[model samples]
Target: MDQNKPFVTEFLETYKRHPALWNAKSNVSKNKHLRNLGIEDLLKVCQEKFKDANTAFVKRKINNLRTVFRRELNKVLKSKTTGSSVNEIYIPTLWYYDLLSFTTEDESGRVGISSLDDDTELQFT
Candidate 1:
C-alpha cells in the first residue's frame, strides 16, 4: 500500500472491487459495449463493492472527485468547441448540465427540447 495516496482510500478500495478493469477491447466485442460501464453505474458499483463499510458520505466524497474531473474535461472540451455569447439569450427555464450524460434539461416541468445552435453539441440531461 502506498502512503499519502492521490485518491481517498475509500475510492481506492472501491476501485479494487471485482478486478475493476476496463479497456477499449471490452467495447469492440459484439455485446452491450460500455453501457454497463456508464459512469454513474460505475459509481454505484463502487458503492456496492464497499458494501456497508462505506456510507453515503463516501458516495459524496467519490462524486466530488468525479466532479473535479468533469470540470477540467469540460474546460478542454469547451475550448476546443468554442462558444457564443449574445447580449441576451432566452433560456425560458432553469437548466442543468449533466456532465456524465452531456445532456441538459429543465428543472421545471417542460415537454419541449432545445438546441445550442453552436458548432459543438453535447447531450443534456
Candidate 2:
C-alpha cells in the first residue's frame, strides 16, 4: 500500500492550490436543496434524520467520525478564510459528488434538462 502524503500537515495547508486535493466538480449534489446548504446545515439534517439511533453499539461504529469531520470542516473553513469564492462545498478528490442537476421525462419518456448554463431564462421550458 502506498503512503498517503496528502495529510502530512494534517491538512493544515490550504488545498485551493492543489488540483488533486481540491476539485469542486467532485461534489455535485442531486438534491439541490441539500446541495445549497452548508456543511453545518448538512450535519444538522443528518443528526435529525438519525436522532432515534441512540444505540451505543451502533454509535460506537463512528468512534473517529467527529475527529474526521472536524478536520475536514476546519479545512473548509480555512479554505474560505483564504479568500476562496467557492460558495458551494465540493467533495474531496477521488470522492463521489452528489449530482445537483435534475432531469425530467418528456412526452415519450425522454430525458430533458432544465438548463446547463447560468442563463436562468433558458431553464424555463
Candidate 3:
C-alpha cells in the first residue's frame, strides 16, 4: 500500500470541497484532473490561486483546512511510530505561507489579527 494514500485522499477531499481551489471549471471531472498532480504541486497551485484572496471568509477556510491537515498528520505520525527509524515528515512550504501570511503580533501581545481586509480592524482580545 502507498504510504501517502491517506494524506492524498484527505487532501483531494478537501480540495474538492472548495470551489476556489479549482483551476478552471469547478466540476467533478476537472477536480479529478487537478487531483492527479502531486501534493507539492497541488499546494503550489492553491497558493498561487488564493494568494491575494485574503478576505475573512477565505482566511477562515484556509485556517480550517490547516487544522484538518494537522490532525491528519498526527494520525499519520502515530501510525508510523516505531523504535527509531520513522521516515521524516514533509509538508509543502506554501501551506504555511497561506496560513501564516495574515497572522501578526506586536510586542504588547494584546491585539491578535489574522485578516487582510482593510475595513476589518484588528481588535484586542
Candidate 4:
C-alpha cells in the first residue's frame, strides 16, 4: 500500500465526522436562498449561513471558503464587465477539502456546474 493512504483515509474520515462540512441538504437549501440574490447580497448570505455551526474549526473553515467564493465571484464579474473571456479566471491554488462542491451560474447567466466547478458560488450561501 502507498505510505500516504492511511493518512489520507484518516483525514477523510475526520472530515466526514463534521456534518456541516458537506451536508448536501443544507447545500441545496442554501443554493435556493442564494438563487435570487445579487452578488453583494450573496456574499452577505454566505457569511451569515455558517455563523451558528457547532465548532470554531468548522466556522473558520466556512469563513475561509466564503472568502474564496467572494474572490471568485468578483473575478467573474470583473471579467464579464470588461468583456474578457471567462476562461481567463483561474482557481486559487489553496485547497478547501470537499467544500468545492458548491455551484455557480456561468457567464451566460445559467445556473449549472461548469468545468471549473469550484463550488465558489453555492458553497456559502
What is the per-residue lDDT of model 1 for residues 1-125, given as tens digits with 9 covering 90 to 100?
24324234444444333122222233222234333343344466455545554345444654665566556556545655565354233222211122222211111234666565557778789
lDDT of 4: 0.45
lDDT of 4 by residue, 61-91 (tens): 4455556756766665676787666676544
All candidates: TM-score: 0.31, 0.24, 0.25, 0.33
Q: Give residue 87's error in model 4 in angstroms.
A: 6.3
Instruction: For each of the candidates, give the backbone clash count.
Output: 6, 6, 0, 1
Per-model CA lDDT versus the true structure: 0.41, 0.35, 0.46, 0.45
For residues 39-87, write the lDDT of model 2, one tens digit per residue. Answer: 3333343344456534342234223333454455566658877776787
Ranking by lDDT: 3, 4, 1, 2
Worst 10 residues of 3 by lDDT: 99-108
For candidate 3, lDDT tens digit of each residue in 1-125?
A: 36644454454565544443443333543554444443334455445545653334344554676576556555555656734344544333333333322222111246678658878777898
lDDT of 3: 0.46
Show the colliding residue pairs in model 4.
102-119
Clashing pairs in 3: none
Q: List the residue pairs that clash in candidate 1.
A: 102-123, 103-123, 103-124, 103-125, 104-124, 104-125
Candidate RMSDs in Å, in order, are 13.8, 16.3, 16.3, 15.7
